[model samples]
Target chain A: METLKINYKNLYFPPGGILMWIIIFLELITFGMALVVFAMYGSEEPEIFHQSRLQLNSTFGAINTVFLLTSGFFMANAVVEFKAKNVKKSSFYFKLTMLGGLLFLILKSVEYYHKIDSGITLETNTFFAFYWLLTGFHLIHVIMGLVILIWTNNGMMKKNSDTEVVDVEACAAFWHMCDLIWLLLFPVLYLIF
Target chain B: MKKTLLFNYGLLILLTISTAVISNFVAIKSLAIGLIMGLSALKFMLVSFEFMELKKANLFWKVSLIFVLFLIVLSVVFISN
Candidate 1:
């Protein structure tokens, strides 16, 4: 009997079924709870809460949104480059995507500085608490995406170039998911109740 | 491939801009939110199918992603309602 070994490049399709759904469902659940808590037990002072929301630099949120979208665009381009077998080009896009992530982090840090200087912390009120919690979760995902990009780019530059493409795509998939989640967060946290 | 790719990306940008604009300008915030969420869902599906190459993927993988997304979105709707 002859055993045919599939190429390492095609080893694992992204995971499916219970585990995958469970992870996404978990995120949805957390977001739902955030919404419900925000509605029911959120700050008693609607005026203050709304004012706090207005105080939020929508400009910064909008800027971060653009950065994440640009990063997602580059990641999508990297997938194209990977499929074209242009490893160098793929790495270039990955680096650009990571740079976008870094820029978003820096802008967020600056926003945090202004927020803290204005005497608003997570402990200030429910509005601030939710703001920090939701944005902080997003920041963590950006950081995770950055780490994935670095690892995948390093592998692409080394001996395991071909095998790295799938993981790279997976990282892009996750980053897109992060961006999608922030799409909802932006309106809910910034514009709506 | 290039045509569909451009179409999807173009639609994605349009949807993003529309979501922001509608949510910001409309007085009916909840309805605006629903629209934004809908548009974002559409954008997510396009990205997953077109950009991620899931259209040519195996059935199990495709269905799993679709199912997962549906469930997640359903949960959000259910909880929000």
Candidate 2:
């Protein structure tokens, strides 16, 4: 019998799984660098950072948490429905998840408006610096997730055969990752003070 | 399936309340943070395993993904201290 040959492309990197792992690893590196910066500056001027952390509105963080978690849940449901081939329900939850992301951005905007109006600029101190850096980074991920959701929704609307289960899974994972990062960040920033 | 779904949502609501309560009680500081984060981790696991159906995923993907996640969290805790 002829020796079996493995196709490199088919061997691994099943599109969705590979993409998910890549994103997770990237986030890990980002968080690592952030921690290193925190360690260095945190050693030099602990109080300033600690004090700035106190300025974070736990209420806003909590609301965003609820929205993102809800979004993640809906996205996961959409994935399940997609697997079951229940197109209508999948579309419904996809839209719901997008709505959740939209609400999160709006709440964030309102929170930012209040902060800027109150003149709590990043120049306030080291704490504000980290506060802006960390939350701002997380906000970027939130926006990215929203864009993915929109694209997925558009694909579904257009009746594309690209199989959106991967999109649903990736978006849900990203949203969940965002929430997980904040789970640590909130307590570190708000509750710690 | 419906029951599991209901239970999942209920647990989520309970976890939410626990997190909120823990946040407000800052006197405990580290303890409160640990407790809330701990609960959130539990919530995330539930969503991943139950809601996302990772339980049915292939062994390699399931174990490796979880391992990576644990490693990430462990690194964070270590670096943080």
lDDT by candidate, in order shown: 0.69, 0.66
Error of 2 at A60 (Å): 1.2
Give the candidate number with the greatest DockQ. Answer: 1
Tens digit of per-residue lDDT, candidate 2, span A99-161: 988998899888878878888877877767777788788889878877877877677656445
Show the lowest summed lDDT stretch of 10 residues, model 1 chain B. Answer: B72-81
What's the distance in Å from true for residue A187, model 1? 1.6
| All candidates: TM-score | 0.79, 0.80
Question: Candidate 1 residues A1-193, lDDT tens each?
Answer: 1123223223144422234334554675576567556644433466766777888987788778778777777788887777677888888988888888899999999999999998989998788898999899878977987887888788778874454445666667776767767765765577554
Which pairs clash (backbone N, Cα, C closer than 3 Å) in model 2?
A: none
Model-by-model DockQ, in order: 0.31, 0.29
- Write one digit per residue (lDDT tens) for candidate 2, span B1-81: 145755786787688778888767646545664566577667756766666555655566566656655654454344344
